[model samples]
Target: MTASGRSAALYRTVWRWHFWAGLIVAPFLLVLATTGAIYLFNDELNDAVYPELRFVPPAARTVPVSRMIGAALTAHPGAVSRVDLPAAPDRPAVVFVAPAGGGEPLRVSVDPGSGRVLGSLVYARTLVAWAEELHGSLMIGTVGDRIVELAACWTLVLLVTGAILWCPRGRWRAAGVLWPRLTGTGRRFWRELHGPVGLWTGALIGFLILTGLPWAGVSGDLLQRGSAALGVGYPASFRTHAAPESLPMKTALGTAPWTLEAAPMPRSHAGHAGHEAPLPTDDAGAIAGVDRVTALLAAEGMTGGYRLFLPGDATGVYTAYTYPDRPEGQRTIYVDRYRFARIGPEVRFADYGWVGRATELGVQIHMGNYFGRANQLLMLVPCVGIWLLVVSGVAMWWKRRPRGRVGAPPPISGTRFAGLVAALAVAGAVLPLFGASLLVLGAADLLAGMWRGRVGDAAASGIG
Candidate 1:
């Protein structure tokens, strides 16, 4: 092959990689973008969908949280596990109840103003819950989680390769290259579809992938552990004066700080470990249960939507935490159940190590929750842009694809091809799964080439 042919060969090689990777990632991209966009409006959507359960009239003083929990327990058969406080007076407090029989937890929304049991739903069966599960694992558990992670890894690789192919070298066109041409047909139209959207929103899509990886299964674990090892993550030694409790906050609460998910929860000794004469309430507060904890949290500057997880046993502490849009308002607090005293120092956004703080902030931006509705709209650019990329990509493939074939780019063998494949090592090193797939693809390609050459040799022998 000549110089241009060699370049074409390299281009074809990358094009093949992009083409196959896009096909695999396209479906997942659609699912993620659609579900992610929906989740961005979780508060508004939930309020709209479940107005009776979620809303109440504003009052000068709403009923106590204790009364709200009481109402929830009266309407359901279970102990209160966690109570998600209302953001405003007009919204109800959602009390999560863990059934004595041991199944999915029940969530009861109670009006704080009137202390009325508005309604109940299974914890995992709510619309938001369903969407969350689908978003996390496609509702198929660990295998699905791995698939999603792999898809995410590949999506990043696709972004890199797509940028390479999209940028014109040795020649440039203002119309088809820089922006989509309004006047076009067939491949031109598809190029118009793929080119501009990919050009503009490509970086944002990459941002979404990186931000989301913290919640992924395999790669996420690698990142967390790696960060911890580097000493830039949440400090394992945060000057905890409390007991060395083994239960992590993530294991205890439904939502926790991204940094402290694996860190052990601060614990306090049981007040009623033995013969209990009903231990006297300490200086923390006169009240107990949800009311005391809520008061304590409110006093501690947790004025936003927060959850107060009730103690499960004698040793369990009440964990109050806020996972809001902006990281600056986020805090995780712990209170001893009986003594009502704080266990450890109040964990704020400032407490997070460098990596933790960055990750948390990125997570907020990724979800479009950092700046309210405007933030949501801004983050939505990539989500909608991905749809356009996928549609245009498929269209371009369909219009030009060879008849009765998958229509992958034709292969060429040369030093350039070898060098290009070698260069992918850097990418593979960064993304282990992507690197592994590349190796698998390379091996398969080698085998297929050998098989084709042998068949050709046999045909020549027969003709001679």
Candidate 2:
């Protein structure tokens, strides 16, 4: 084939792969983008939704953490329960203690002043949970999760390839190529749908795709390697050898370089048989429950603002992660339900693994939480842009289908093929999902060429 012919063939090959991948994943991608957009304002939205549950103050002579625990156990006798402490200063202190074997946790909002159970409710209105499920896995569990991960990582290849196709080689109309000049209905509609939208939303969607892949189990390893290359220290060592006592929650909280921080309360992981007291074994009133924790925080004057995570299993410690400012500046503290003493090592945002830190910062950026509302509002432009890219991509594919009985053209020249191969290789190194996809694309292309070659041979034989 001639040089120009080869270039066009190469472009078609890439376009084919990009087209198929986008079509298969477009619906899921849209779901992810939409849910993600909603999640971006979770802080503001959640507050507005449940102001009553969140807006409690520290009253004088608040009940003790120990007393609160006793009260929760009394409320739900013979239940294996945990408590989630409110991290924010404005939010009320809630205890979540569920019964063993069945039923939901008893969620009670305590007055903290008299250990009075102010109101009881379930942990419902879980929009964030729903958003997370849709965004992460499309509500399809592991397989769905893997597909999303692969799609996000491969999207970079699609973006790069699409841009190449969009740039007309010699017949480049500057305005048409770069900016959409809406002269007629066709131009105006196409420009509105594709031209301007792609330009504006590219970076935002790119950020989302890049940051999101790391959370996928498939690309997690590649993300870590990339993070290490960027001079950020990803966690190289697991804390298996370190004793639970060695890592106190107070020490972790102190790592945050914040002005005001709370001290962790007395707490312990159940069945961790190492240092202190025997695990509490009373039928109804053995361990200090959630109410006691709220009161203790108030009594100790640790009430600038705080959050509490209820212990999950029998062995988990009730963790308290505190944030004074909305964006930066956070501290973490833990308390043992059984002992009512502090547990685990203290750590800060910066102290987390490199991937963890990046994910945190990325989340902050995604939410417009880092700077303020102004920054958040500015991000809406990019979000809309991303939606446009997905939509236009589908339209372009639909418009390009063959009219007659013509099959796909032959494979491109080796040189152009080599360029695509190289691109895929580099992308794979940064994200394993992309790396794996390159292999899949190559195999698919080779098979297609083989099938076409055989058809040509049969046709030639018939003519002879």
Candidate 2 per-residue lDDT, tens place, 1-464, comes to 79888877877887666666667667767777788778777777767876665567765555565565566556654343334445544455565655544565456666555665555555533687677678778788998888888778767766676666665677666675576665645334554457556665677778877656656766754454455445453232223215344333334322222111112223344565343322223433334465555555556555535555554344545555565434345555556767766554444566655555656677566656677777577566666666777777665554554676223333444545777667677877767666777788779878988888899999989953
Q: Native-vs-model 1 lDDT?
A: 0.78
State each model's CA lDDT, in order.
0.78, 0.58
Tens-place lDDT digits, model 1, residues 1-464? 68887777777878978999998889988988888888888878887887787778887777788888778777776677677887787878888776656677778898877889989877577677777888889999998898888889899879988998987887787777878886888888888768878998999999999999899877777777688768777665643533243555666554578887766665557543321112212212322466777777778777648877776656667878888778887887888877777876787888778989999999999888888889899888999999999999988888888899888877766445556556688778777776788889889989999998899999989953
Sequence-dependent TM-score of model 2: 0.74
Candidate maximizing lDDT: 1
Q: Roughly what TM-score does model 1 have, to 2 decimal places?
A: 0.90
195 Cα displacement, candidate 2 (Å): 2.8
Each model's backbone clash number: 0, 30
lDDT of 2: 0.58
Report the error of model 1 at residue 44, Å: 1.9
